[model samples]
Target: MNARIAPPATVALQPDAIIRHARAVIATEAEAIGALEPRIGTDFVEACRLILNCHGRVVVTGMGKSGHVARKIAATLASTGTPSFYVHPGEASHGDLGMIMPQDIVLALSYSGETDEVLFILPTLKREGIPLIAITGKPGSSLARQADVHLDGSISCEACPLGLAPTTSTTAALVLGDALAIALLEARGFTSDDFARSHPAGSLGRRLLLRISDVMHTGDDVPRVAPDVGLTTALVEMTRKHLGMTAVVDADDRLLGVFTDGDLRRALDDVGVDLRGATVTELMTRGPKTIGPDKLAAEAAQLMEKHQIHALLVVDADQRVVGALNIHDLLRARVV
Candidate 1:
């Protein structure tokens, strides 16, 4: 008699309740974001002006989902020329607050405006006289009242079925933070080059920062065989240079043609081998893929990848060979 009688069997959902719940959540949050555009006020402008003029870094902090948004905002600000870093509000009391200087601006985030971890640092912020920008749902909450500039992140209602979770509120807060960062970014006139400077470790950074001169093998290091040179010597030059190809140039260093490992293989595979009788002039390819010395290494990489070639002859404006480069060089220089 565990329950005195058997429990009623539950019916299967016709389509499924979970999908309906998820779609409703997305719809509500999308509407919340749509509402935020017209609500931006003078306080938002002031926040941007303050951050733009701050000589010190922007310190972003929050709790839970807001903390995740704070970290992204900090990254966006840093990449867009506004120096910034994220601090965990909970960790601030554990000595991480030392990262913040009095000169810095602190951006605090809370949903209901009563997040304990965020409020924990209010005393230190006040004692240091640090300027604060707050993002919260409730205007009258302690965190909002204490903030020098309070950004309204209120939403009509959360997407949760019970209207209890932080769905729509978090979306509004994140979008608002992005808007602030983008406004400051535009005001600062940040450029792609400036962004590359901040992100020097990635492939995109290499494309922006690398130039032809950085990866080219110049002067004597260039493997060049004279047009009149025998094919045997040309093969020796190609092998010694290790660039998978050798340039055929005249005494004036004007390019004649290029001979590669592929060319050598083709030459051997020929129906009739004319080794001793042939010269590099007859065996090499004339007018190969050539790049200017001042061109970006990224441009050279594009050309090579497009043609499926491994090397290029670096020439001056007059088309005279000044240097040479290969995909290997690009790989080593991180320009590929």
Candidate 2:
């Protein structure tokens, strides 16, 4: 016969109690993370030096909750210029141990510093001459004693009500991992451009790596008209290009001014102006704001926002009209 499962017990809900408990957890974790500031001394420095000097990737390993934190730390290090990856402790004991090399450094995380799976691979790691960095709550544990550099991740107590679940201890380990990644990032002089390269598909990559030339309308797509053209001709060019404006260039295609919808509005408002006889030069705004095609698309967005204009003409260093772009182009590229 199949066994029958018992129903879960019903309890009364209390909003005040729930909020109070959440606030207490936050306070405890904050205190635990704050306490770690003083503990970052010689051992932290040594860990950074070991990873920086190592020719191979930093292999992070842990069990249970520490394993989750280790994965995050490895990702942060990899994205921030330090090459690193996470390996499961239990998996490492099996054939997965072959993934680690002698030149690589091993970073182990365990709250008790005596996890059996993590310890099981220590003998192999030592035999292969791989350097070890250990982070644990217990300073005198076997893992800490055996590590070339041990970072003390001790916490007064966990934020869990039962004090059994990994809470404050996990937070401490995560923060320590971040501290190490950032220190090495600074020591290596990593820049935002370098970070963007690792995240090419992200919005940050689009902003940093995207150039104006990559998004601008070039050649015949860019609306251009001679300065001597009538206002009606410029309007037709603007309508055909759909950029809300047309560049007024000389015979050599060098920018002289820009004729925009705003200028047309002002021309219409002036009863003294003759619409039929007016030339593009008479209505054009002289010395309009422009950008080089080599400039970043982000910079073009900044310029447009600062000037309260919707469009820009891309030019060469010698003032030759090369391309054109508007806020809509940036929006389509998701750079705005």
Candidate 3:
């Protein structure tokens, strides 16, 4: 029987050495990102133009680590006004090639530029007359040579100490993809509202698209009292509505003033003040800050924050109370 060989002894790094290695890794990645700055030239701009002029989706394809970067690029493009989706290069040869349309642009990534799965689909892409953009480390490789536009994603060296794993190269490619997407986004003049339309379920979209009218309490739900009403009657209205405040209005429902819980506390603490006979207008804050129903709910939140108040009256152009809301309403609507 052969003697069993003992395993090599493990060498544990010191705490300082581990920290130094981590800092070196970070610095290497930062240098990789910095190296991408000069490469964002005419080729990058041309890639943006190709994608912008495409009438169909930007079909991105890659293998292995490049595939992950390609997926992120596709998502970034789609969310930033550019229509894009990723297709696995290996699957493309297995009937996924039909997903690519004539008008669509193809973005292919291959670090070595010789990935068989990606190379196999080049003829089909070329025969179909689709514009191809290649992101590769090798400028003279078959993939780059066959592409209509080539983006060089070369790196000085892999951040991996052994120089085998894709570390710096992947970072450079990902940053390049971001550069292309942002350049296209700016060129298209994609506004915040346009982005909100694409992200309606997100908080930013809610902040931008949700109007004050959508969340305000209207009709009889609003806590409102006549200006001539007594403080006790206004407090009753505020309590019954559970909005923490009440609007003091005239007979025509035009806003005259606002009375809040803070005001109620002040009224109760005043020395020798006759709360029973005092009118709401006499104690309420006059010409209080108001917002239009057409304004965004986020604007209402800002107004509330600026004045350190919790409620706001939604008025029309004619300055009549159309609705009312408090901080609780904004919170419930997820607009704050």
Which 10 successive residues of model 3 have the least lDDT summed?
32-41
Using lDDT as the measure, the top candidate is: 2
lDDT of 1 by residue, 1-336 (tens): 475778899978766677787788889899999988887989999898888778899999989989998999898888888889999998999999999999999999998899999998899999998999999999999999999999999999988778887789988998998998789878988887888888888888888988898889987889998888788898899888889889898888888889998888888888686978788887788778899987889999999989999899898877788999999889998886
Is candidate 1 or 3 superior in lDDT? 3
Model 3 ranges off by over 4 Å: 1-13
What are the TM-scores, per candidate, against the unseen true structure? 0.83, 0.97, 0.94
By lDDT rank, best first, the candidates go 2, 3, 1
Off by over 4 Å in 1: 1-17, 218-221, 261-275, 317-320, 331-336
Residue 335 displacement in candidate 3 (angstroms): 2.2
* Displacement of the residue 74 alpha carbon in candidate 1, Å: 1.5
After superposition on all C-alphas, the RMSD of every candidate to the true structure, in Å, is 4.8, 1.5, 3.1
